[model samples]
Target: MKAAIIGAGPAGLAAAEVLSEAGVAVTVLDRMPSPARKLLMAGRGGLNLTHTEPLDLFLSRYGAARARLEPAVRAFPPEAIRTWCGGLGQETFAGSSGRVFPRAMKAAPLLRAWLARLGERKVTLLSRHAWAGWDAAGGLLFNRPDPEPLVLRPDATLLALGGASWPRLGSDGGWAPLLAARGVALAPFAPANSGILIPWSAHLRDRFAGTPLKRIALSFGGRTVRGEAVITAAGLEGGAVYALSAAIRDAVAAEGEAVVTLDLRPDMTADEVARRVAAPRRGQSLSNHLRRHLALPPAVIGLLREGEAPPETAIKGLKLRVTGVAGLERAISSAGGIRLEELDEHYAFRRLPGVFAAGEMLDWEAPTGGHLLTACFATGRAAARGMLRAMVG
Candidate 1:
């Protein structure tokens, strides 16, 4: 069987590997001059491969689409990913937060090794060929540099063009209009794993514009996460905010604004915080008191002052209103895409047969720190299996 996989990111790569292993001839295609530009960017901060938590808890990260996603995840899990990496000669280690990373801890090395193995397995890699819509027979059409176009007739084709977030890296929702033109229903892509915009006082913005808020607690819609966040002149960014991004995005869409409260110190209770603040302050200023008493970081202190300078007791529990969320251009990943209703359990387009979709291109969103990559890999493998089954049947 011959297969063509589009978008050479994690999903497409995984699909290629699975099909090749199953003795199916595979050709992977990418529009970019290089494959997996987003993957390489994800690795800039150590390339989180997967999480190390228990299966149930880790799976919970997928949220509303857990039922749809669990099957694929069970098929190719974190352990499977780790094993795959090990085979690529990249050993993985779990960080303090239980997130997994390769020993090399970089995307380039792993991608290079992976491409080498794919070459060894005889999977063809086609780069610098942008995929146009399918032909009348649903055959893949490509636009090469300064050429008319090339038509590829594969036994099966998988579209993993990714969601719209970083258009520069090539997963621009550019595929949406193409698929929609073919009657494929697609949800409007919105930003996920992105920051929110909170108007900060000019005074505070000047001091803490680019500061990091370490070890704080952020709460939204009954969900709480303990992580570090960075304060930008425009708003909040970092792991903590991204954790609550989905909820924040939904809430913002529903209402004009959303209010998210930060414990700023979840490790301490109201009483504890009150006690800490009540500590005798003889000569030190309020800023000094907060800095020395609560051991608040300079950024947090500056942020608190920016919003409102409350009485010592009032500082125990603070409230902040979030006006809006960051835009798609600044988001790490996008949320909405082709809904699961468009595809069957096999990740194959129910209406468009002999074609499959995988990865961020599918309708599901998760935070950073491996959830994104994990789901992409799992769905790609599942889609490949679907293609293999179709070929045999």
Candidate 2:
């Protein structure tokens, strides 16, 4: 059997490996000049391969999509990914935070090893071939830079085109319209793991645009995420903000904006903060008092003074109005794609037989810290296995 895996990101690559191993002649195609552009970019800050947390707790990171992704993830869990990396000559180790990374601390080495293995398996990788849906004869149409588009008739096709984020690195969400035209159920694309946009005053934006608020807790919609957030020219972003992005995005969608409560010092109680603030000032200025007693940084003090300084009890509850979410181009990842209802348990499109999908193209969203990459790899393997089953049956 022959299989064509479109979009050479983690999902497509993983699918290619699985199908090729199953004795299928596989070809991986990508629109970019090469492949795995996003993967390479993700490693700029030390590639986070996966998380070492317990299966149940780790699975919870995917939020609403946990149920849909459970099967694939369970089949190829974090341990499997680590083992796979080891097989590629890239041993992985978990960090203090439980995030896993290859020993090389880069993506290029792993990708190079993977691509070499693919070459050994005789899996064809065709770059600069952009899929343009199908033609009249049910042949896959791809538009190259040249005049005539290329058409291919493969036994099975897997569309792993990613979500609408990091367009320059590929995954521009251009596949959504094509899939929608084919009567495939699709959910509207929205930014996931994106920063929030707040109408910050000019002073705050100018002074603290790149400032980091370390050890902070952000609360929204009765949920709280504790991590560091950075002040951007437009708003705030970081691990914590990305964790709560779904709730904040939904709240902003339902309403005009969402109010996020920022806890500058989550380690201390409000009463403790009050007591500290109320301590003997010794004729110190209010700012100095805050700095000395509360140990609040300049950025925090400036942020507090941006509007009205709340009482000590309410200090931990400083609210910021989130006007919008960062655009897809700026988002780390995107949410909403081909609705899962359109597919069977195997991830094959029921409306289009012989076609399967995996990765961010599917309607699912997960935060950073390796969840996204793990799901991509898992789903890719699952889709390939589904194709193998179908071919055998």
lDDT, model 2: 0.92
Question: Residue 41 error for model 2, in Å?
Answer: 1.4
Position 329, candidate 2: lDDT: 94
Q: What are the per-residue Cα lDDT tens digits for candidate 2 across 1-393?
A: 889999999999999999999889998989999999999999886889899999999999888889889999999999999999999999999998899999898999999999999999999999999999999999999998889999989888999989999999999999988888999989889999999999999998998899999999999988898889999999998999999888889889999898888988899988898889889989998788898999888899878865454634456888888999998999999999999988899999999989999999999998898999999999999999999998888
TM-score of 2: 0.97
The sequence of per-residue lDDT tens digits that candidate 1 reaches over residues 184-265 is 9888889999999888888867877888887788889998888989988888999999999889988988998898877677
What lDDT, from 0 to 1, does candidate 1 have? 0.88
